[model samples]
Target: MRLQLNSSSHTPLYLQLEAALRERLASGEWRSGQALPPERELAQQLGVSRITLRRALERLEDEGLLIRRQGSGTYVSQRVEQTLTALTGFSQDMAARGLRASSRWLQRGIFRATPEEALAFGLSPTAEVSRLERLRLTEDEPMALELAALPVRYLPDPQAVGDSLYAYLDLHGLRPVRALQRLRAVAALPRVAELLAIRPGDPVLYIERLSYLPDGSVLEFTRSHYRGDRYDFVAELKGGK
Candidate 1:
């Protein structure tokens, strides 16, 4: 599609182009992960100099609406912003944003708990746990890789879980009341890169969470790797008086 800049408008040329590009993205004219035309080609098509085009594109990149890979052209971003203050499951999170959440199951079964797992659950070493591993997706686009473990008593049938583990737990009255989460940045491994459709060594957000029941016992232990480019975690802060 050709984009025409209003030459007589008071807005800067690059800003006009930026707004046009944003409109296209919002209209779904350019879908996520779809590569934009080459810089030269797009500049010529928009009747603007390469410098103006680059400036506009740079703004979009900063806004997380575009991604430019080294040696690869720019592509539309599939980024989503999430607030850190909420205690919600993946499904609920996506739903709040009007996105459909789905999962590609990797593993779901009962297994002997490791020493660390046993300690986390305050259970005996001989105790078993249920493990659920899956690729979390939205609109068929992979978003995160998750591995969750729970005491077998809480999730006796791992297969019983559907799209949302929290929902399943709620149904059984095993939902966690609160959680402690830690997040760090890490390079994506080859396996993770392939699954998330990103390059190896790309930045990823590694998060570990321990969810607690009302009695203060650990109910779930989960580790997840979120696509750094696709996730913007926000936190609201209040200043002290």
Candidate 2:
């Protein structure tokens, strides 16, 4: 096998090894169910410590791309395959792969709208809004905690909402044409930490999104905190030639 390792890059040695192994797997350089090189000797050849090599192996094992056997050694896994696509929702995305999805409705109440909510939904500040909070789960694993606000003037009833808010909007002729979302990393709040079962100072993904209908009316304003460990947001760039 041809091996390439670069130590001068800013990337960590473990990450570099992980990426290299991933590239080899993607390029069919390593066949499925085949054994990879031993850790100690390969570490020496790659000019990385055995700990670094093991960290890379651990990542691959966690990703289900590598299978580690106690006595036999590490081998390429045959059970890792998934088609990734854009415009995928958690429920539909997980269900397509035969994984289950469930949501625990945290709160459904009406309250006086805030100024920000008014601006998002184009409603008067005095307007009341129906609020929805849910802790979304996949295969019983916590994924995200969602807090959504909708103008009661448009959606007067909160019980009318089903599993998916997007589906509910579609049913009410409020199907969103486009959505603008902002993403940032923030320290988890105490409440968020408690709900997500993480430490308060731990990092979490903060996403604020505004969905707009074709009629130019904002359908919903949602801010969600996603578990960083379970999610990897990818963006593809198509360069203009």
Candidate 3:
């Protein structure tokens, strides 16, 4: 594989490396569990500093897209396990792990839906939606700030919804059978930093998840801000295919 760097591009050299490698992965040039060239070799081949190459690889590893072994080498990460199966609620997952989970509800009100909200929940933009904003905790440690909006027509009383949105769905038989989630790394904002008790500019996980019921009805549109230092995406995978 050939890696190119543009010294003139304002983007950092490490980020450039990340982009090149990600492109290779996306194009199927590198398959899962495939070993990457050694840091020194790749650095020399790309005419860049070893430090830059190492930093790039480390970033990918942190993202769970690569696996590094001490004294061995680095390789592309295998896909996460059980990603295609199971739809468990956060509260239930935490409880199953012997951890206590709770939420500090911030806002509970029915508000006019925005265009984005309407599209996400399959409702009219002028329709009302139940908005929920809360800080979540596990073992008394702040983990995530969850902001969710549900169609008010489906849930009449905002006060009735509690910490576990899934519980409310289950009671009404609207539990989601599947969901689509997107995650990105972002800097913590002032208000979110204050709530998570972290400094501004600290790394945070931005997750947007849209869940739907078995009948294909949109149940919830949630955006959660998770502390990068405290939360991780864990997956288990099988190899034999």
Best by TM-score: 1
> What overall lDDT, based on C-alpha atoms, would model 1 receive against the true structure?
0.90
| Tens digits of lDDT, candidate 1, 1-241 | 6677888989999999999888989999888778999999988887899999999999998766898888989999877888889888999999998888899999999998888788888889899999999999987878999999998878889999999999999999988889999999999999999998788888999999999999998999999999987898998999999
Instruction: Encode model 3's per-residue lDDT on 158-206: one tens digit a residue.
Output: 8998778889889997878899888899999999999986778889989
Off by over 4 Å in 2: 1-89
Look at candidate 1 and tell me the lDDT of residue 61.
89
C-alpha lDDT of candidate 2 relative to the true structure: 0.77
Best by lDDT: 1
Candidate lDDT scores, in order, read 0.90, 0.77, 0.81
Among residues 3 or more apart in sequence or in different chains, the pairs in candidate 1 whose N, CA or C atoms overlap within 3 Å are none
